[model samples]
Target: MKLDIQHETHYEYSAPLRYSTQSLRLTPQPSAHQTVLRWALQVPGKLFAQRDGYGNEAHTWTLARRLWRGAIHAAGLVETHASPWLVDAPALPSPLLYLRPTALTPFDRQLLNIGAQALDGAPAERNLLALARLVRERVAYRHGVTDVMTSAVDALDIGAGVCQDQAHVFIAACRARGVPARYVSGYFYAPDSPALASHAWADVCIDIPGRLWLSVDVTHGCVMDDRHVRLAVGPDYAACLPIRGVRHGGGEEAMRVSVQIRPAAP
Candidate 1:
């Protein structure tokens, strides 16, 4: 399946910004499951491209001039393949590298307790699904309840959150259970529902015989497929945010994001 995706984020401020630099992790990863034919990122100023530690293509954009408002847009054409849950021979040094927890995804006592109970007797292939179930069951899919700053433990406490919260919970749990897991930021194509484009999921590296990274969608309660486009992977959203920056002066900020993902014409 091929897809055409347009993702744009607008930030408005009451006052003009002096200087700012934002790091963008918008480039899609061409892997066993997907192929990137053409992709581009459009913003206000010059962009310096580099590869992150996790191997995702990251770009830095420095503000060329002062502005009261800024916008970041990315348009791309990608051909996806029917890939199984397994990502064979990932370029990472070892799955253990993801064991460490982040501020947004702390493998704390509460999460560790959950992981211990759910994965005690589970098999490697089924561990991720079990974790995904735990996330969905514990935290209902309720948007606006949590923000980007929410942590996995806090989401579990609130019992309501969005896809990002779900992914964080699952990642935290997997790491607690001794399975290396990371967070994935991407786009999901729902043909009938073009409005729901941006998506997030969990990636647990199972060091079984073949050593595969399992892609788990806790919100959808299933493993990912061709409809899932891989954008970036990191310990948490803080590391792989779509648009994150530091500015000198920006009062009363307002942000709006619009995304459209649909099947490409034959």
Candidate 2:
């Protein structure tokens, strides 16, 4: 499967900001599942800029008056050539490592305990698979109910959430069990489904030697594939993003986003 993608983020400020800086992790990676054919970004405002060797654009927006916007558009979308081998990612050169606790918060620790209890005597992969299946079966897909900051416990208690919520729940559980985990944001190119174009998921570092990091999309209840176009990868959403900046202004700010995806013929 192949697709064309468009993603845009805009900010409108009530007052001009003095200055701000941000880090971006928006560039996609070439994994066993998919490869980046073409990608680019556009900033429609005054800002400073820098670039990594990989050409992932990182810009700093400064001296804004009323509004600022950053946009990204991509095309030539493709799916993973073959199904990801969950237990045998070692066959692939670039493998993910399991996460270890680093400055975990009290809440994070507690969540790990719960995850362990929930999947007693089960491997991390099996636990993740079961939990993901359970969540999708129990929770109906709905928007406007939660955001990035919402915790996994919160979503589970409420019995409702979107993809991000599911990913958070999965991450929280994995972290509870001393496994390293991260969040992923990208486009989900569902060939026949038309519910949503964008999607989010989580990855965990299992005990598997030389093949620790494996991605699982809890929302879709399947391993990530070529259709999964990655934008960022980190312990959480806060760490992984294409561009994140703040302006020192006094008033409220409005934001707008525009994303487009054109899929190739199957």
Candidate 3:
């Protein structure tokens, strides 16, 4: 299946920014399950600076920029940043990944306790599948419950969240269980649906035989398919913003993101 995606983000400042710099990770990855035929990023302002590279990683800015005297609008630019990397999750020592407990991050420790209460003696695979189902069934998939700043624990505590929140919980659980998990930001095409929406999911690097990295959609409770377009992969949202930027002389800034993803006509 082939999917065409168009994502546009606009930032309107209360006052003109003195200077601006941005880091964009909007390009998709071409792996075993999907392909990237064509893509582009449009910014209707000046082309001050940008960071274009491959792989799933985050950005950090040490210096800020001053605003130019004139308004900047950069648009309609083709970015040649695509890779045909296969999803090959290398196998880990079975003893290390499962059937044994490992050191955990502060957040991971809390998740382990939750899993112990919610899922006792359930195998890792079964636990993940069950967790995914629970997320969809228990949480009301509504807007306004969460924003970009909402954390995974907060969403779980509230019993409500969007796709990103679900993905975070799924990732946290998998990693807590010693499985190598990551966050996936991309587009999901729901056939015969009213409109398209940008989607997020989880990928676990199960060191099983043959396949290395497997993608899982906790929001939908299934494996990702052709309808699942790959964008970026990282440990969490901090590394997964499709587009990021920094501006100097910030009095007040209003950022708006409108992503329109649709299927190509047959």
Candidate 4:
């Protein structure tokens, strides 16, 4: 399957800024599942190609002069030759590198305890699926109840959150059980639902028969497929966020995003 993607973001500020800069992880990385046929980034200023630590192809955008309103757009075509198997083998040094606890994905005793109990002698792959399903059932999908600062424990406590929260909780839960997990940011091709175009999911490195990274959508309780176009991966969302920016002299800024993923005509 092939998908044509459009991810556009607009920033409106009340006042002009001396300069604005953004690091974009908008380009998808090469993996066994999919390959990038062609891609480009549309920005108000200049964009330079940069490689992130996680081996993702990122771009740096800069509007070095005064600018009040600007839009950053990413348009691309990715062909998905996905596998239905529950395993994804990427060329990473070691899965243990992702086990370190971060502020957004702190390991909790209760969460860890739940993970251990849920496994119940099941293989790590099976355990990850069960845990992801349990998280989706536990945390209702709702927006505006959480923010970037909300930790996995906090989201679990609230009992509701967006995809980010679900992914974080799932990552923490897996990590708590000593399973190496990472966070992923991507786009879901929901033909009927545009809201799912910008999505988040978690990946866990499991070693039962062999080592493989499995992508799990905790919010939807399923393994990822062709509809999922991965953008970036890291220990957490903070590292793989699509857009990370810092601006000067802009007061009370507002942001809006639009994403569309559709089948390419052939």
Candidate 5:
């Protein structure tokens, strides 16, 4: 399937910013399941491109002048192929690196118990799928109940959060069970669910030696397929944020994001 995607992010600041620098992980790389036909980024700054530690294409955007408002636009055309739930790719950074807990994916006794209960004596894939389902069940999907700063344990306690929270919980549970899992930030083409266009998921390393991964959409209780477009992977959302920045000023900042994904003309 071919998809045309457009993402727009606008920020308004109460005060002018003296200087600003942003890290962008909005570009997707060509992989076994997807091919990037055309992609571009538009921002009011000097942009430099480089590969991040996770082997993901990253860009650094810098604005030296003072500004009170700014906008970022990313447009692309990608072709995705249908494949099994498993993601087969070379492990650039060892999968073991994902086992370490991050601020967003910290595991406690609750998470350990959840993992033990869900993955009891099941096959690798089955156990991971069960874990995903259990996470979804524990954390109901609801907006406005959580924010980007919410951790997996906090979201689990709140019992409601968006895809990001669900993915974090799933990652925490997987790592608690001695399974290596990483967070994936991407786009999901779901016409019925417009808000889900900007999506997050978890990728579990099912076969460490073979470097095989199972990409599970914990929010949807299923594995990733052609409908998903990969962006970047890291220990947590903070590591692979679509856009993160720091500014000298820009007090009381407000941000708005819009994402659209559609089938492209043949």
Candidate 6:
């Protein structure tokens, strides 16, 4: 399936900023399950292209002039294959690296309990799906209740969160049981569910020796399919954020994001 995606992120600041720099992980890389047909980024400053620590196609955008508003636009055409699992080509970071805990995915007693219940059986694909389902049931999908800084434990405690939160909880649960799991940021082509267009999911290492990963959409409690266009993978959302930056003097900032995904014209 070919998908044309248009993403726009705009920021407005109460005070002008003297300098700003951002790391962008908005570009998608070709894999066994997806191919990037065409991609581009439009921003105010020059974008320095480089590969991030996780081997994600990344860019650094820097603006030295004073500004009160900024915008970033990313447009791309990608073709995704219908694959139940993603096999990572032999890469730098080993699967064991993902098992390590991060600030957003710290170990917790409640998360361990959840994992213990869902993973009572063998660590098969079905059991992983059950773990995702359990997360979805405990954490109801509700907006405005959680922020990007919310951790897995915090979201589990609140009992409500967005896709990111759910993914974090699922990752923590998997890691608690000595499973290698990582966070994935991507676009889900669901016209009826616009909010899901900008989505987050999890990738569990089912066969570490074979470098096979099972991509799970915890929010929907299913494996990823052709409709999912993966952007970046990391230990947590902070590492895979589409745009993360710091400014010198911007105060009281407000941000708005727009994402549109549709079938490409032949």
User: Which candidate comes out best when scored by TM-score?
Assistant: 6
Q: What digit string (tens of lDDT, one per residue) describes model 2 on residues 1-266?
A: 56677676666556654455555555565666666676654555454556543223445545444434334333345445544433333333232332433221114654665566546653556667776776665455788887666666667667788887777777767766656566777777665754456677886665446455567888878777766776655555555555666656536767676556666665
Judged by lDDT relative to the true structure, which candidate is superior, 3 or 5? 5
Question: Residue 197: error of model 2 in Å?
Answer: 2.7
Deviating ranges (above 4 Å) for candidate 5: 84-91, 121-123
> Against the true structure, whose lDDT is highest?
6
lDDT of each: 0.84, 0.60, 0.58, 0.82, 0.89, 0.92
- Taking all chains together, each candidate's TM-score versus the true structure is 0.92, 0.74, 0.73, 0.92, 0.95, 0.96
The order of the candidates by lDDT, greatest first, is 6, 5, 1, 4, 2, 3
User: Candidate 4 — which residues are off by over 4 angstroms?
Assistant: 84-93, 120-123, 208-211
TM-score for candidate 1, residues paired by index: 0.92
Model 6 alpha-carbon miss at residue 54, Å: 0.9
User: In angstroms, what RMSD does candidate 2 have relative to the true structure?
Assistant: 4.9
lDDT, residue 253, model 2? 63
Q: List the residue pairs that clash in candidate 5.
A: none
Question: Per-residue lDDT of 1-266 in model 4, one digit per residue for the tens?
Answer: 89999989998889887777889999886677788898888899878997777777898877878778888888999988764233434554467878888999997986786577665653355667788878877778998999988998998899999999999988887788777788989988889888888999987775633557778888777788888888888999898889998888878799999898999999
**Model 1 per-residue lDDT at 140:** 93
Selected candidate, larger TM-score, 1 vs 5: 5
Worst 10 residues of 5 by lDDT: 82-91
Q: Write the per-residue lDDT of candidate 5 for residues 1-266, one digit (tens) a residue.
A: 99999999999999998899999999998887789999999999878999888878999988988899999999999998855344445648888999999999997988999899877652277777788888888999999999999999999899999999999998998889888899999999999999999999988887777777878888887788889999999999999999988889989899999999999987
The order by descending TM-score is: 6, 5, 4, 1, 2, 3
